[model samples]
Target: MAHTAGGTALTPAMKIAIAVIGVLVVAGIVVIAMLNTAGRDGAEAPPSSAPTTAVAPPTTPGPLPGATPTTGSEVPPPTAAPGTGLPPLAAAEPLVAAPLPKSGSRDGGLVAGFPTSVAEPMEDSDVVSTSIATENTAMQVSLVSSTTTALDEIRAHYRALWTSLGLREQPGDDSTMAFTGEFESLTLNVRTTGTGNMYTIFGVLRTE
Candidate 1:
């Protein structure tokens, strides 16, 4: 053994002990490092392949229970009413004043066997309006005022006049009268106006 200044040299036993302690420490460190690496790998590993719960989308509202479905086409038009095919009623015009057989003395009066009469020539009595004649038919609407003649008397007068002319009376009520003959037909409608002293008469005449 050699002695240095103020120091002693180490023995082989002491060196062996130190070497074993270092080996033990290194082994412990390696074991701790392996445990830490295992913990980290477990935390960072990919998840399992099992199916996940799926979140459903929100729902939309539907139509009411009894609602009817609409179509793209347009609705159909309404049907026409019954008995609307007759000619329209129009206002009367001036008369043509053609000569007629058996006509009344009044200037605008009906011809013999006709349905209506012109207003009598008196104060405030005149022909109001007449219709233009077609090929074989015409109409006249007039207003007649009389202080002496009642509505019943005028109606009766017309009835008697039509019967005397050999025109057969068609079935009608008090407000309407119809007469037919061999070559002509007539229709008369009368209504009282203004205190029952004036009467409006509408007549249609047709000739063969």
Candidate 2:
């Protein structure tokens, strides 16, 4: 065998072969040792918990900028009553103030008991009607169709019924005439007032 450096007994081919085998054995042992250690560690260790990712902090809601909260003392609503749609009422007439006055006559021509009187004359185309009223008595006089044309004829008729009866013909004020008369039964006071053509008669008839 040929020795290269010092006084070695091995040949060059043998040294090469020995070095290759030793490298192979060491590589094999290293692989087996690594596998054994991995098995042992894996078996002995407890299961690893998953990495606890840093959890985000719970998000808090922000308050509104200028909002106001309501208090408990709020105003209550109004309640309506029943029967809201009733109709309007009408105006009333006024009452008369004074008691009826005494009849116009003191005699019993128109009435038997009470004194004050008022009267009216109605002249239609063909007929005439007279109405007389007294404070205590009432009388109605009617003039039928007659050919009398003069107002004196009507006045004389009433005067002749009660001889001392006088005629106060009120053409303007509130009446047309206030006739005072005395009949055998009572005294009569007749007041006649006219508006346009229709004549109203108010009377007072009483005892003499």
Q: For residue 142, what is the lDDT in candidate 1?
A: 38
lDDT of each: 0.55, 0.42
lDDT of 1: 0.55
lDDT digits (tens) for residues 1-208 of candidate 2: 4565768787778999999999999999999999999999999999988888797866974445675545643466787776768787444221111343333332212333222222222233222333334443333332223333344544544445433333333333332334443421322232322422222233433332
Report model 1's TM-score to 2 decimal places. Answer: 0.34
Best by lDDT: 1
Model 2: CA > 4 A from native: 1-8, 48-208
What does the lDDT come to for candidate 2? Answer: 0.42
- Against the true structure, candidate 2 reaches a TM-score of 0.20
RMSD of 2: 19.2
lDDT of 1 by residue, 17-95 (tens): 9999999999999999999999999999998898989988558545557777567333678987788787985543322
Query: Candidate 1, residue 40: CA error in Å?
Result: 99
Model 2 Cα displacement at 52 (Å)?
12
